[model samples]
Target: MHILALVLVVLPLAASQLIGGPTTVDVNRDDVQQMASFALTQLNTLLGSQNTLVSVVQAKTQVVAGIKYFLTLDIKNGKETQTCTVTVWSRVWLNDKQVTQHACTSRTKRDGLVGATTSVNVTRTVLKMATYAVTTLNGLQGVHNSLDQVISAKTQVVSGTNYFLKIRMSDGSQTQICDVTIWDQPWSYMTQMTHHSCVNAKRRDIGMPGGLFNADINSPDVKNMTNFALGELNRLQGAQNSIIEVISAKTQVVAGMNYFLKIRMSDGSQTQICDVTIWDQPWTHMTQMTHHSCVNAKRRDIGMSGGMLNADVNSPDVKNMANFALGEINGVQNAQNSMVQIISAKTQVVAGMNYILTMRLKEGDKTQICYVKIWSQPWLHRKEMTEHSCSQVTKRAGGLLGGVTNLNVNSGDIKEVAKFAVREINGIQGAQNSLVKVVKAGYQVVGGFTYVLTLSLKDGDKTQLCEVNVWSPAWTMARRLTDHHCTAQTKRQLAAVTDADVNDHFIQMLAHYAVQTINTLDGTHRAYVELISAKTQVVDGTNYFFKIRVRQGTTTQLCDVTFWRQVWMNSMGHVTEHKCATVRRRNVGGVEPAHLSAPLQQAVSFAEDALNGKMNSMFRFVVEKVENISQKASSATTYSFDLHLVSSTCRNNGNSYGKGITDCTPNYGMLQRMTCEVTVEYRPSSSRKYSLAADKCGQIQLV
Candidate 1:
């Protein structure tokens, strides 16, 4: 069966390179019919075998030309009536190096057991003895050159560690193959193998272990050997479990399987374990472990490579943890407090000298307090005193005593109190060197008051002043005393009139005059006294000089009266000369004679008539009456002596009294009557008075 299998495998390679080779094919008589058909079948079989081998060789040659590894085989078949010869030629290449002309020959004969009627059987065998003899002879010549080439090709290196091995037939045909070997460490080799194994394993058929090969171990079948080897490596490498261990050389602790250990170098430069076996661990630990050194006894958490666990967690000095926490809390509190204080201060209303100040403390609590102090000046009191007698005295003074009130003190009142408080401060008196008294009176009003004094003295001398005044309700007068006699008298007589006596006399005289004046005039009328020089006189012949002002109720009146009796005697040198004249005038009559002459009478009459509203005009009456009357009077005697005398007096006096006289006159008589009219315009008793007078005279009269 093995020989048949070998024959079946080799028969297809006999067509192309071995043109004159023998070929064989198997047949069953039951499936064949006639002799011609049998022969045609054999021929077709032989030709088909050769053509199939040639096709395979052509395909392999195309592959070798295009790619790095390839194999090609050619078969030549020759057939006789009962015998056939087969020649096989093969070409193989590994990574551009090639060996050609490897050949093998075989012979086949018909053989069979007689079946029902005559059956045919075929027998094939490699011509080893004949091929050896041919090979030995070819070796002596260059016919074995291809064999040497094949031997050289087998020893040639192709890939990194792969070599080629060749097998050649005695007919100058060959088959080429590859032998691959990896020189890497078991771990690296296994790691790569593991990846390929996993890929293949995933594609395996059910119940079949991947890469199982049914080839001889001594001469491995290259077609499936690589796959089988990779699977074995995969099993070996994949068996290693990932473990955690400290790598002192790398200053790291790592977790990974053998594959990771094989691929990565433990240089501190690469701190992270990137292997898939260690992928389940935390990344922080992975990195940290890769960098950890044996200098520390314990492994740090995650990325921290140095410092003890207790030191990192418990020591405040390294982190300032307490201060940081406290700072956060204080910052929030301060902000809140600032806001509260701002609102409080903003809401508070201040007036006058008060101010609102906002401040914040440790916490957020807010308080608003107000302060106020009333402002005012101090009041002063004044006083005065006078002496009436040795034991009788009166005093009077005025004062203003007042103080500030309604002071409101609030939470912020300290500054206001300090600013406005009044101590016993110094003060100045209105009048220095003047007798006065002063006292503090303290804060008499709601707030406080200061007092001072104003004093007046009868003698015009006062005492030293003081700061304030003492208030009192009293009246007193200042007094001075002196003594003198009414007349120039001897020293003894003046001495006899003591101060009291002189004072009494003066008082009595003043009282008597006051009484007489008051008795003679009503209260609305003021009384006055005057002392005048003896030479002073009035038109009424009275002389006295002194001016006195008297006030009755609220009215003040000035009056000057010159007494004639006192003044006349002083002028007459004590002679009673005016007594006889006064007596004669009185004895003759109480009325005086008509002293005015004829023209004066006429003028008076005319003035009287005109004043009686007889004339319609102002001065026309003078011309009409006086001129006409004078013209009619022929002789001086015809005019009345009164008229003549009055005219002469008017001429002597040079009086332009026509309007006055005319306004006052009446109808004319023998001597025209002259009139005198006085009009008094009186004001109210409280007002000033005025008067107007009119007199009449003749218009044209001889004098």
Candidate 2:
């Protein structure tokens, strides 16, 4: 009869109850919902008839003497969905359910926070009293605490009235935020400062962390020193690393000037955060790293294994140790030698982040690549620049130039590198493709030598291109492909992506979809035959070049098709045909022929009628592109012509079919872009219709 019974009977009991255990049950389970319903009714009854049951939003069950339901209910309490927490004990078998504790909050009236009513607005009277209380505290503690601002306050009515205040002090640095209490009884003519204390983070310096200060993040001196530290790291660590830009910088003057920098640096292709410290002593011409640590873009440690491991130019240990080393170098040169770049470096942890490096550094206008080694411990505040040798950096061939790049490919070294990469090819992809020749080659020095070779691999009768990077050390004959990508070619080549066969069903489907999408622009219903050939070039995305055979009416023809949709699009069933063409497709479609035959006139008529039927009901339209396909003399498919049709509109056209919309656009939503089709041929007499024309799905003339 009550709302609780109405709710309980409506919900089906779906939760399995286990006896003698507390279980977490889905809140939406029917049994939980049913329990929630009963709990809400009991809550209403226990709390008088004031609060009404809105909905049972959550429930937790404990199997006790019967079942105890910990319920959080959204009640109809005049305001928005205010929450009412209710706990109920139920023995459904005995049909006995009681609202154990209706609120979770005290069910009975209770004084708030030991009988003090809190208020946020600190009146002038409250502040004056708080000041007096603080004064009493200061006199007793032998300190000064002038009031700045009131944070919070509480008032209690006793024989007279008392005020407790929390405030920020204007004078005291450590005890900025403190609590003070004052007893006031004006009728009895009594006033006394009773309490003074501190709470939470504000107990000291208003919750600020120790030894932390804000500094200009874009300080120039900081940048220069930070850059100097990074350059030195690349040297000592033998890393090809460079800074992107500075994020933040701070400086402290101690034994010298210590720079604290946070910056983004590039270690090969990865960009990471480098927290670097560069200690510079210009007066003594000494500069070196104190510390350098790197974290990923997410500000999480990169988990670099410790050792004399190869590190980025931004590695904390490398940077700091190098800074110390550089400072010592400056002291030795006394010529203000500044680091330009690190050519190569190797470091092994000894006392601290220490390094032996070959570096390109600048002394005034002159720069030299030098062999330098340095070691230091920041805690000891000492360093030793052990070795230094230099030669002016010169432009020369056969020298180790930095970075991965395209270089001369006709050299003897190129040939050797190609052969080396080829020798390791069998281990690559474990496929049947054999190397015919190397298409191109580039090299970079990384500990050893790495060659990026674009190879022409032969698989069956197909020739596909595979680009692989092979790493080979100078001495050993062992060479390994670090990375590679090879594609499939019809019967000619097949990519061995982990030993998958060439006749994979997936490959065939892609081949078909790719062909149809290309011809879709021409609107020609050509049946796809066998795949003649298809090859892929790997770049940021794959470029698929396909040679597919398809049927037109009674004759079979070869179409050279190209598509740019992502390769995964085919497998994901989201293939969008971006581009397609017949064999010599580039030359296949172009300008409309010089003369239109009588049949061309009638065929053009049919095409216009079909397209116009699909257009907006209000206005007949003109197609922007007209492709002229005439029966060729030999094996040629069709020649196309691009015709730009001017539209008769008052405003400009930026491809709004969201171009010419409302009642003027095509009926099939917006026929935004039409690449192919609408082949209507009628050859009765020399009937010429001057008004008809189209685009990929454009212009028309009968043949």
Candidate 3:
């Protein structure tokens, strides 16, 4: 059965109908319709398909950063047997940027389809959908820029009496993002609608109103002065030059009236300065025009240059007015000056140098405040007077010379700072243990009276330098500076080395691997074996550091000889008490030091079997004591060592059980012994080269 349905796909409904959020009612109807039309056109292209019918099912509207519309459409395509649903979204922003998106899926078809449409009803369906979409979009809000115009129109449309919108610009002090729009009305159509504009809610005025006068500058004398002033102003404006002048004119003031200055020129140019004085200033009486000047004047030792106030008059009225003006200026300065404070500081005390002095002055007081930083020697002279407010004083004065008072105020702990640095380098996502320790701390002369207290920190292979600048005088809290100069102890500049025959080079490379293996064991900063010594074989035999003794019946080889890895003090002979670490474990049955000249035990076993008459195997081997390695090329040098082999034909010099001795009788042991010297080139590189040979002699067979 073919069901016929015609549905319109459109933008979202009014914000009020969707949820309790902002409604952009203040937007102009024309602009809103234009935006909606643009969005609908784009939607058509996105949803266009061959032999497909689409209809709007539902629309949702929301208001957050801007207006957003979510539209649900029912889609049917002749190519597909199943129906699908498409969701289209459109977001309109205040900056005239519009974004629209749509997605279609055959997953689940919503139940709100008006009805199915046959081929004959297809044209009707498309027209109905387009019309509905355009209508709905035309009613949607436009870009917020035209908010003011929409609000004004709305106020005039009903009766030209009621004002419905107020526009307010946002300042940092405002807490909420506000958008004002008119309430949706039934009589207003989308094509002819107006909107409201967001505005800062007016703050209630609690202070009692004072008496003030509304001035008229239309009088003959006033008109002449205003005309001249206007001419000067116009000339300045034409030249695009700034004019800095004191405006002083005689004008009569009437109590309890609004003041206005209106200027009119013959050429139809006009100028007006209305509401020159708010309710804060009151005029007592109307009198003949009198001259009042405050040109670079000083009253009560307060400099009033660049400002005009009635400080010349001794009358109570003039004094009150002057006091009020001074109070306001002081209040503004105080707020700005108190924003910063130096709670701690550091400074250098020079024996004979003279430093500039800093001091704070009282409000409205013009006296210079200065205090020279001095020592026992003769004071140096400075001619300039450095001016500083409360905030600038601490920073400009070098430091609080007296000392710090609060050590904890506004200062980060040095150890904590170092730990944070390490964590960042190691990529730790959360807080972890502080791995650095302060080594040395002292004050250093930086510049003038400013000094930075520096600290040195060491943690395993990491080192960090920290500097703290605390206020002097009462050294309590710091201002402006605290930092850590992190230096990884293990970090080294790569060196170019070509020597591959040095024994130290191979040992160094092996040592580095051992260090890495040790670090990976528990993943904590631990001591590394920074240096390795070569094998020392004495006459008593395998007594060297790299050699191991295999007893008569033991299967142990030279590889079993393990070194206890620990960190040693670079300057001292002893190991580090806390940073020292145990040896790293190997893949074998026992743990061993990673730093080694070679797998000596393995080499020895291979050599013994190869030289023995039983095994028809051959292997070249070497053993040697690592000699001195130059400090400059230690990181990149390859090492070489001489391998010494001592083998002999011998039987187990002990008794064995007659029944269990399958391989050899107690006295007759199947063994061959021989001695030879071979050289092994040990490269710190990934590959090692060795030369080994064994020839059979009459009684001794060497392979």
Candidate 4:
């Protein structure tokens, strides 16, 4: 027989409480089988000899954690037709000691022929073989404990197979105490250590002592015998009953609420049974009673449910349900209940007590047995009922169970809700236009069937769970719940909007507009421009003005634009500057508004002369007010501005000695009275200055 390597090494440590050695103890069936096989091989070899036809007939092994165990073998040995029945008992002590004893009786023929009998005393051989097996176990420990030497080990058997071990080792600073089981006991023990180094003594109470002895509950063979009974139940109930998908099996063990399963049998017939029968305790004889602990209950005591989804223990369903429960149970943080096991399964109904379903199927001379653990009442407190009881029985072989199509509310739809929420929160009008990204979706169980799913949404730097909905299996509709639960919290160590992020976005927009403006200004049809740098100033903590430094083949110009939140609340009614809208506030280096006044014309002429190298002077103009005439797009792109210039000034390069002597100054009153109808074209560009898109500069008319 093949055994896992981990089982070989780990199970022996658990043997301490039973066989006595270390604080850690774990037992496996393979170890017991190995011991039995080894003892039988030695005995078979010793018993074989001349003038004797000795052949091994049958061998069996029994191992219990806290009990002395034995391997029994029946052999037939005789000459000619005469035969003798020989019984062999291979026993092992708790301390890794092995011993074997045999009793033989010869059968004489009715013809009066005497059978030749030999007296055999195999004491020395048995003791030698026992010593050898014990020595082999000792050798195994040497390698097993090579990492951590067991300084001292003390064990105390509680009552039955339950026991505790106290051990001190040189590897750790503290002594380790743990509870273990002997011989595959029914009680559940804490397998994990208390600390990283070793389990503490506090975990010892998790194991219970004086566990009730029910061989069918503890023995794999006896438990498997119920599979036929279960198959018979399925055959009887196969036509009328069908399986239902369970939302949750263990924690929510409500009768008529939790759904059971229907599995297709190899015969193409659906096994429609969801309940188990306890043959040891007749169902009719059962009484409606509750027990504090079902593991300690007897036939006269309380039993678990019958048809509850959680209580249905079909062979395949048992493992599937157990695995599902484990995943959900383990997800709980710092769970007091770590493991689950089904100690008893019966058809009888015990009020408010957990039980296992039992079934038996008879095929001519053979019987197929099945068992299922049912969880009811307060399931969390009854951790023992969470485990599976039908390990020995094989799952019914078939393709798959057929059921009505259940429209599972896909989690993928959460993205849509997130998009909707992002649109709502970010004021996006449609899902396609919304840039809301779903970060994660968390699900919460509601009404034991439906789920309230919350989706975390992200828009640029802002994040929130903007969308929540109720989703359930078999329901086609994903009902919108609420958007109030999700609120944006700034990411850790990240401010609302970084200077770099704002700058980058602004630069990108400016680059796009600048290229377009430059192409229109210079008529070069260029697709790109060299961005010098943006000079920014914050105003009223709400608006940001950018002075874009733009250059096109050594022709550098400065342009100005302001970014601010729109005057109205976003479509979602959220007051946020997540997306900046552009406002053409002024001309280059000028405040107020843009106008085609005398000062503006003089400044324009100065700029033209400066570009032509005809004048060595810096030009300045004051824009009194500017109005955008273009329709607003998703982003600030192109805009038409009506300019009103107030004043203009020019400094003569020859007047260095006189400091700032103006070569040409426009009349302020004259510029103020005129509302310049010159259309100042602006697009997002690298240079802050707007190029003459449709230069009708001198066409300014007085308002």
Best by lDDT: 2
- Displacement of residue 202 (Cα, Å) in model 3 is 54
TM-score of each: 0.11, 0.23, 0.16, 0.16
Point out the higher-scoring one by lDDT: 2 or 3.
2
For each candidate, the alpha-carbon lDDT, in order, equals: 0.22, 0.52, 0.28, 0.31
Candidate 1: regions farther than 4 A off: 1-393, 396-580, 583-604, 610-703
Instruction: Count backbone overlaps in model 3.
Output: 57
Worst 10-residue lDDT window, candidate 4: 250-259
lDDT of 3 by residue, 135-248 (tens): 333245232111101101112112111123222221223211123323222112222213323333333211111111222222223333444444443432342212121122
Which candidate model has the greater TM-score, 1 or 4? 4
By TM-score, the better pick of 3 and 4 is 4
| Winner by TM-score between candidate 3 and candidate 1 | 3
**Residue-wise lDDT of candidate 2 within 119-172, one digit each (tens)?**
533333454566567667678767765544456677654444567787654332
Using TM-score as the measure, the top candidate is 2
- Measure candidate 3: CA RMSD: 38.7
Q: How much is the lDDT of residue 229 in candidate 1? A: 27
